[model samples]
Target: MFASDRLELAERYTELLATEGVVRGLIGPREAPRLWERHVLNSAVLAEAIPDGVSVCDIGTGAGLPGLVLAIARPDLSVTLVEPLLRRTTFLDEVVAELGLAHVTVVRGRAEDLHGKATFDVVTSRAVAPLERLLGWSMPLVAPTGATIAMKGQSIHEEITQARRFLSTWRCGEPEVLVVGADVVDPPTTLVRVPWADPKRIGWPLARDAKRRSGRRDRSSVKREVS
Candidate 1:
């Protein structure tokens, strides 16, 4: 939930999502009416799972779903919105400026593009990819003690089963499934949090690939860093 002081900002963001968000094809026209309930509030609840004053990176954050929402709700968190599309990043940059969210940073690039270059206390995503693929892109950006917290649907149990091999190969701890915003939202939000099995012994199965990719100069141009 948003604090009283931050409620107005949240409202403004909702309006933008209904207007510019829809016009740019980021949000569906049908979704405009239920933006608050289905999107904003659902995303806001994710704050409950995060710790205070942590650095967060939300990958594939098209139109900044949970990422921008988190920044509005928790001013203490330094949020980085990572998206691959320029159009989406444009809208995100505008929203950050309009809301005067100084702690937010907008990066136009894929999550994999940040591997070996940056890491955050918390890496987040919403319907970006499946569990197995998500682990490949997210784990590289998760700090030794940090975790990847993604919003998932009811098929989470099945997805976890399919990703069992990946969890073990990457030395990830048991995935913790949590339901947040039960009192506020009807069905509530389902989140899957995956952390390293041992902070002292983090695994980087793709570190070599990340380093090779990071060496490419072209990749740098694709990632736009806007504060």
Candidate 2:
């Protein structure tokens, strides 16, 4: 839900999505009529799952679904919208400027581009990819104490099952399926939260890559030698 002070900004964004968004093929024309209930409000509801005052990265954020919407709803959050498409980033940048959302940053790149360079309290996505692939793209950007929270549909359980091997290899804690915005959105929103099993030992592959870069043996070989 948007604060009273920010409600007008949200409305402006919705209008843009309905007009410019549809004209540019970002949003289908059919979706324009229901942009409020189906897109804007639905995305705004995601705020309930996010913590206060956190750095968030929304990857593959086409037209900045939950990312831009969150910025409008929660000024306390620092949001980064990551999209590879120049067109999408263009629209996103324009909206940010028009809305005067100082807290938002638009990054024109894929989720993998920022893997080693940055990390945030939350890495999020909507209709970006399946759970298996999403983990690869999202988890690396997640800070040690943070998580990858993605909006999912009814097929989430199947996706989770498919991602079991990835979950284990990445050493992620059990994925928690949560329903947020129950009172706000009629159908509500389903989210899957994936955190590191042990914050102190997160980023297994990144650690290995770092060891290689430093010309050092990986933990496994080092442990074997000590044994």
Candidate 3:
């Protein structure tokens, strides 16, 4: 559940997505009826995997799927919605302004183009590209010791197998597939979590203390949810 303010913003966002988002060709018209279940809630459930008070970058964020949803669900996070297209970013900007989400930022740029410019504690993407290619573009933006969380559908296991070589090359650990919001959302939400190698061993900067603090929050929240 969300607070009163976030719930109101979520409603407004859903309305915008069903109407303006459809008109602008961002979301298909037929998807309006299932917008809450298939799109908004599906994305929002990803917050279960994200830690509190950490930076998150959502790459290829079309219409701010998981990005905007995450910002709404977890106000503790610093969320960046990155999209390359002007039209998509325009829509995102308007939604962020209307929601008055001070913790969210909209950036217009491709993930590949943003290498070395910025990095995040977590990089997320949904319906973006194949897992192999997605890793190529997203992994570079993940802070050393950070993780890339990709929202994948049923074929995720196969994609992980295909991406094994890339994972090895990048020194990433084995991917973990998690199902979140099991009771809240039908079919739940599937996430492929890939953690980068230790920074010192890989010649990158050391991990930040902020991640540890957020990790503690993550554990506490999960405990409460399970109980």
Best by TM-score: 1
> How would the candidate models be sorted by TM-score, starting from the highest?
1, 2, 3
The alpha-carbon deviation from the true structure for residue 66 of candidate 2, after best TM-score superposition, in angstroms, is 1.0
Candidate 2: tens digits of C-alpha lDDT, residues 1-227: 88899999999999999999999999999999999998888889889899998888898899989899988999888788888888899999899999998778777878776656566788889988899999998888777788899999989999999999988888998999999888888899999999999888884555223222111122123223222
Q: Give the alpha-carbon lDDT of every model.
A: 0.86, 0.83, 0.81
Candidate 2, lDDT over the whole model: 0.83
The pairs that clash in candidate 1 are: none
Residue 57 error, candidate 2, Å? 0.1
lDDT of 1 by residue, 35-137 (tens): 9999999999999999998878899999998999999999998788888888999999899999999878788878877887666778999998999999899
- The estimated TM-scores of all candidates read 0.91, 0.90, 0.88
Q: Which regions of candidate 2 fall more than 4 Å away from where they truly are?
A: 207-227
Model 3 lDDT on a 0 to 1 scale: 0.81
Error of 2 at 111 (Å): 0.5
Residue 88 of model 3, lDDT score? 92
Give the runs in model 1 whose Cα sits over 4 Å from its true position: 205-227
